[model samples]
Target: MSLGSRSSRRHHRALQHRAIALVVLASVLVACVFHNGASNGSPGSIPSDLEPGDVVHPSPIPGSTDQTIELARTKIKHIVFVIKENRTFDTLFGRFPGADGVTQGTTCDGKTVPLLRAPDRVGDQLHSFFDGITDINGGKMDCFAQGGYVQYLPQDIPHYWAYARRYTLADRFFSSIYGPTGIEHLWTFASQSDHFIDHERPGQFGSASREFCDDPLETALAFRSMARQEQERIYQAEDEGAQGLAQIRASLTSRWPCFDVKVLPDLLQQRGISWKDYRGENPFVQPLRMVRHVRFSSMYRNVVDVSEFMRDVKARKLPAVSWLTPSFKLSDHPPTSICAGENWFVTEMNGLMRSPYWSSTAVILTWDDFGGFYDHVPPPHVDLYGLGPRVPAIVISPWARSGFIDHDTMEFASVLRFIETIFDLPPLTSRDANTNDMLNAFDFTGRPRPPLLMRPRTCPAR
Candidate 1:
C-alpha cells in the first residue's frame, strides 16, 4: 500500500480507457459507411465484394453533361416504349452471338442443367416476388429449376432475334423490380413503387378480378418496410427459422393498390408533352389506371386500346411518348404462342417504320420480368426492393448503334432517365435520378441508319 501500488492501478485504468476509445472509433466508422451508402439511395447492407456486374453505377452528374442532353433532345422527338411480358434475356437471346447470355443454368441442389429448347407454348412457372428471391438464392442464381429452365431458339422468335441483330441489344438490362406483371408495370411508369413488393393477392385483395385502383376499396397490396432497421432485419431474415421469417413478413405494411405518388406522366403533363398508354386486350397491365389522378380524372383518356397505336401512326397522330402493352396471348408469357407475340411485335414495328414518324422516333422494346425463365446473371441489390433479373431490351432507332451489344448495368429507371434527359424533365425518384441515361446505345453524330423491316413468320403446328 505505497507509491508503487498506486502507480500500477493508474496504468490499468489508462489501458481500459484506451480500449473504450478504440471501440467507439470502430462503431463510428461502421455507421459512416452505412450512412454514405444509404445517402445515395443504395442498400446500406450492400456487400463490399459485389462484382462490377452486380452493381448499378450512376453517371457522373444526373444525366451526364449538358452537351449530351442537348444532343439527345435535338435528335429524338418521339419515343415508343413497347413493354412485353415476362421473358429473360437468356430465355430469348441466350445463344445470340456476342450477347451476355447462357445456354445452361445451375440448380438449387448444385447440379448443372442445360437449357432445353422451349416450344412456342411452354408451361408457365412461378414468378412472384418471393419466388424471384428464392430463384436468386442470395445471388447464387441457381434456383431457376424451382421454376423452369428453358430457352427459345432464333427460329421460335425470328422477329425478336432479327430486331436484336439490326438494332442495339442491351444484355445487362434488369427489371426495375422483382416478378409478376402488375408491380413491374407500375415501376415502368413510376421509378418508385411506393414500397410495394408484389402484386395484389387473390383473396387478400378482394376479388382479384382487376389489379388497378378500380378494384374494391377494401383491397390492399403488401409492401416492404423501407426503414433502415426493418430492411436490415428482413435482409438477414432470409436464412432464419420459419417462425422468425414469418414474424418479419408479418411486420410488412400494406396499402391500397392505388398510389398518389408522382410518375413520369405527371412530368410530361407539366411540360405539355404529349403521351399515351396504349393498352392491349388486358386491362390489368395498364399502370396509369392504378394512379388516383389518372384513374379518376380527365387524364384517363390518354389510356387507349393497343389497336389505336397503329392507327395513330398511320394518321400521324402519334404522341411524343407512347407505352404499348400486349394482350396475354401475344405477351410471350409461357404457354402463349411466342410466334404470335413476335408477329404482333413485327407488325407494330413495320407500321412505325413505314410511317413518317419513323424518321424521328426511337422505339424501345423490352420485357417486363424474367417470367420464371433461367437467367445466369444475378441482379444487383440496389435497395430493399430490387434491380431484378436481367431481361431483354432493344433500342431501335435511325440513330441507334446498329447491331451493337451494350453491356451496361441498368434497369427500368435507365429508360426513365433517358426520357427525362431528352425532354428536360426532372427525375421522379432517386432510382431514376442516379441511373444511366442510355446515351451509350445511340450515335447522335453518325449517319441515321435505314429501317430493316422483318417479315412475320407463321407459327409452327403444335
Candidate 2:
C-alpha cells in the first residue's frame, strides 16, 4: 500500500510541473515578439488592429535614413523657428484657403456662432490646463464660445495672411501639447514637459476660466498679478552662483517638479551644429527662463537677446538653428492688437530674406497653443501630455513648395524631426521619431525659388 501511494503522488507532481513549464514557454514567446518588433527599429505600431480613437501616427511623408540626411546636407542650411503665444488655427486663419478651418462653432449651450466673422478684438479667455480639458470634452469638438470664442480676420493680421498666400500653410498642424504658454514653450525646445501641466500658475487651475467669464476687468488685474509672481519665480536664482543656485534648485525641484532632460539644442551641440535661442521679453515670455535645461546648460550663454538675431543675420553669422521669441505686445496674445504681431513678423522675415541666408533658409512660423479659441476638429488621445487644438503653421523657404497646403497630421515635434533628419542627428524621443518632418511641404528635387517679398498692411501704433 505504501509503494503504490508514493508512485501516484509522484505522477501528480510531474503533471503540475509540466503545466507550469508550458505557461512559462508561452509568456517567453510573447516577450520575444514584442522585443523583436522594438529591436527592428520600425516606426509606430500597426494601425489596422487598433480601434478608431486609438491611432498610431507614423511619418506622413516617407524617406529612407540616407535620403533624409542627403536632403539636409545638400539643400537646406538654416532652419528658423518662431514661437508665438496662445492662438488657434480657426481663430487666426479659419478663412484660409485649403485648410480644415471652422466657419461655424457649436457653443457649450448647444447654440452655434459664426466663428469666421469675429469681433475686431476679442477679450482674453482662460487657456489653462483645466480650461483645455473642459473645452475638449472628450473630443466632442463642442463648447468653443463657452470656453472663449474668437476668430480673426485678414484685416487684423494682414502680414500673416499674406505670408500664407505666398508660401506653404499647414492647416492640420497641432500644438503637440494641450497646455498653456509655459508648457507649450517647453515643447518648443524639449519634445516633452515635466509632470506639471500648467506653466507655473499652479493656483489658477480651476478658477482661471470661471473668473475670466464672471468679471473680465477683475480677471485682467488678477492675470497681471499672477504674471508678476511667475516672472519672480522664474528668475529667483538668475544671479546666484553655481553652488548657491544648485541649493536653491534642490528646494525648487521639490516644490516645483522641474524635471531635467535633453532638448534640441543639446543634439545640435553634440553633432557639432551651432544654434541659438533668442529671448526677447520678461521672464514670463522668455524661452531661456521658462525651462530648466536652458537655465542650467552651458548653452544658456547662447541665449542672447532678440536684438542679436538681427545683428547676426546682417553679419551672415546666423547659426544652423534658431528660435525667436516675441514680446507680449507682438505675440498677439489676447487683449493685444494682432497688428503689432503682424508687423513685427513681416519686418523680421523680410530682414532674413534680404540676407544671403534666405536662399538656404527655412522659416517656420507657428503659434504656441490654441489660446482658448474655437476649432471644429477634435484632437486625438495620444498620451498623457497631449496633441492639443489646431494652430496655424507656415513653411517659408526656397525648398518649400509654393502655394501648397499640407493636410497631413502633424504636431510641434514634426519640426524637431525635420531638424534632426537634416542635421543627421539621432532622435530625442519616440514622439519626434514618429513625426512626418513636413517633408511634403518641401521639394529638394525641384529648382530653388527666389524669396517672396512681404509688407505690413499698415504700421501698428505702438
Candidate 3:
C-alpha cells in the first residue's frame, strides 16, 4: 500500500469514531430530561394523582385515609389554586351541558322566572344569611326570584366555559360560607374562622361593620391591609341595611371566641413539602395570614408577589402547592370587567401549559362566593356556618377527566381535602374532614392528557 493511501484511511477511521461518540451522547441527553420528571412507568397503574400505575380514587371521601395517601404521593408535583370573585352556579353555569342546572324556577308568588342571560353586570342579588332564609322562604326556594335572577350563556364567559368544557367541572360545588367575601375567604383558608363572627353590626364592635376590616394591624402591612380594608368596606357596604343584614348580624354576634386553627399549608411544611401563596393586592390570603400558627411559622415566607410565581414557574422553582389571587381589576368582582378576569386566568394557565412543569401540575379555578345572584338547589345544610350557594369550579390537570361533570356535592374546603389527600397532610378542620375531595374528576391510571392551550376570547385587540 502507498503512504498517502494509509494516511487517508487512518483519518477516516478517527472521524467515524468521533461521530459514534456524538450519537451516544445525544441519546443520553434525551433520557436525562425525562428521567428526572414524573410519570407512571405503566398505563394501567396510574393513580388519581396524575401518575400512571395506581388506580386509587382521585378525590377520596373524608376519613378514607389510605386512598388519599395513595393519590397524594403521586406524580402531581404542584397544585395551583386560582380564586376569582363573586358568582353563582346557576347564574354562571345554569346551562352547562350535563350538569345540575335550573330545570325550573318557581317564584314566591307562584310564578316562573326563566333562567335567562344576565346583563354585562347584574347588580348584587341577595346572598346574605337573611337572604338565604328569605330566599328559601321556609324551603320554598323563592328568594332567588326576588333577589336577582340572571344566567350567563356560553358567549358571556367564552374562555371560562371553554376551559370548563375541556377540563373537569364540579357542578355541585358551593361556597364555604354564604354572603360576601370577608368571612367566606376565611372559610376558604381554614374552613372556619378564628374570630367570633357577627354578620350584623355588633353593639360592642360598633355599628360600623368596617371597623375590624383591617387585618389586625400586625398582619396589615405584611399582607397589604389597606386593600383588605377597602374590600371589607365593599362587602359591608353591599350588604349593609340590605335584604338580609339581620341574619348576617346574628351569625356574626354568635361566633365569638374565634378559635385560631391549623391550615392545610402548615401541614405541607410539616411534611417538608414546598408551598406558596401569590397574594398581590387581593384580600383572600389576608385571613390566612392572621392565623397565629400560620403567621408565626415559615408559612409567612410563602406569601410573595404574583410576579414571583411566574418567575418560579419559568425557572422551575415552583413549590408543591400555590395559591394565585389576582387583584380587584383582574378579579370578577362586580363592576370589574369579567373580560379582564378571563384574560388574567388565560394568561396564567397558558404560561403553565407552555412550561415543562405543566405535565406534573393541577390548577383549580373557582369563584369565592355567589355574589348575590340566584342558585336553585337549596344548599345542603352542613352546619351553622354553611355550605352556601352553589358556585362553579374547574379542575385543570393532565389527569383530569375530559368533558366530565362531577356531581359530587362539595364546598371550598373540599380543595383542602384534595390537598391533604395528595400530600398526605392532615385535614385542617371538620368541614373538610367529611366532605368529598373531587375523587371522580381525575383518573391517574390513564395516559396523561395533553395540555389545553387556547387563548382567551376576551383578549384585548392587538
For 1-462, candidate 3 gives per-residue lDDT tens digits of 999999999999999889867754643342222211211122222112111111123333534456544764575778898888788778778888767687457776788888766666555554544454455443345656354677777888888888888889887787876555655666666766543232222221112323233334211101111233343332332232244444334323232222356666767777998888887675333555555666666667887887788899889899988888888668787657777788888888888999988888888889987776777765544433444677899999988888898766677888877787777666665566656766568877788878878776644332
Which residue pairs collide in model 2, if any? none
Which 10 successive residues of model 2 have the least lDDT summed? 46-55
Which pairs clash in the backbone of model 1? Answer: none
Instruction: Please give, for residues 371-461, the per-residue lDDT of candidate 2 as tens digits.
Output: 8888876654354445677788999998888888876666788888788778877666666765566677888778887876776666545
lDDT (Cα, 0-100) at 355 in candidate 1: 87
TM-score of 2: 0.74
Q: Rate the local accuracy (lDDT) of all candidates.
A: 0.76, 0.66, 0.63
lDDT of 1 by residue, 1-462 (tens): 899999999999999899867754643342233211422222345532211121234335433567876887888999988899879999999999977678999998899989999888888787766667778776678877444788888877878888898889998788877677777888888887776665565321223456567765534446443555665666555322232346446756666778777888889999999999998876456678778888998888999989999999988999999999988788887778889998999989999998888888898999998887889877666665566788999999999999999766678888887898889887777677666778889888889989878788878787
Q: Arrange candidates, best lDDT first.
A: 1, 2, 3
Q: What are the models' TM-scores?
A: 0.85, 0.74, 0.73
State each model's C-alpha RMSD to the native. Answer: 13.5, 17.8, 19.9
The model with the greatest lDDT is 1
Give the least accurate 10-residue stretch of model 1, judged by summed lDDT.
47-56
Model 2 collision count: 0
